[model samples]
Target: MHPKRKLTTVIAVGVAPLIAVSLPADTADAHGWVTSPASRQDQCFAGTVACGPIKWEPDAVEGPKGLKNCSGGNAQFADLDDDRKGWQVHDVNASETFTWQLTAQHSTSTWQYFVGNQKVAEFDQGGAQPPQFVKHRVNFGSVRGRQKVLAVWNIADTDNAFYACIDVNVRG
Candidate 1:
């Protein structure tokens, strides 16, 4: 064989496996956000709310710890932190079952919901793997009228959490 051809063949043989091995057969999907009551990101995804990059991946608004804000510490989805935006309001009674859609299921530590400074409900997953969907029944107590509810999903292994803000009109 010609010297150049031989070198080419050797290089191809050496590089082929690396290329194939680098290709992933599947990626572990592990992200989720509240959809019920129409979270801010969910509304953006539905075109009901005009937002930034979060409109594309509504469930992936993750950020570092101590993110009590609606953006989950991400500035790209900061529109969620704005109460002035015309977010769609879902009317509900004192209690409602909130649903979270998970594209990739991950072990969760806890799921919490807040209204202003008050935490109305929480679900402790305790590092257990969650299903495709997670549900929590939230109570508004005596609070009524329109309010922005914040939802936080704390991942068990990560230092980050996913955040969602849902606008709701509570009726007694």
Candidate 2:
């Protein structure tokens, strides 16, 4: 083989595979979600919930500016928005402490929980940095039976938030 042809062949064989197999940039943030009672992301990461890329990066459910959907406004995480997914329901009393396991601690403004359209609880951080584990004692009030809770973690510096949807049976 000619010198140029041999070099060209080597370059094509080595570089082409790398280009073809390369993934997108690492846009994953190290934020987190509820894990004690098992949030949807927790289930996905634990192989209980069938999910997409989120199964690999459970702590990366950051959303667009000011959008507080069940899936953190990310279509990749849309499985969390579905209530009929047969998610494992954790049984809890009216008042219970829910914990968020943070992979990367970010300055937070507040954490809020909602049942349907009604706000059930809020924990204000007041733009302070949080610990690796942030706990909130939430009360479901008069709610009973199977319920989906939407949890939001508002980042203080940015306009985005982390979201987690947890299915639970509210036992009186």
TM-score of each: 0.84, 0.81
Task: Give the lDDT of residue 43 in candidate 2.
Answer: 93
Candidate 2, residues 1-172, lDDT tens digits: the string is 9999999999999998798779677764588989979998899899997877888888888886455566887888888777777688999999878899998889999898988888899989999999999999998899888888888899999988988888899999
Q: What's model 2's lDDT at 63?
A: 86
Backbone collisions counted per model: 1, 0
State how far residue 51 of model 1 sits from its true place (Å). 1.7
What's the TM for model 2? 0.81
Off by over 4 Å in 2: 1-29, 65-68
RMSD vs true structure, all candidates: 2.9, 6.0
Candidate 2 least-lDDT 10 residues? 64-73
Cα deviation at 36, candidate 1, in Å, is 0.8
lDDT at position 37, candidate 2: 92
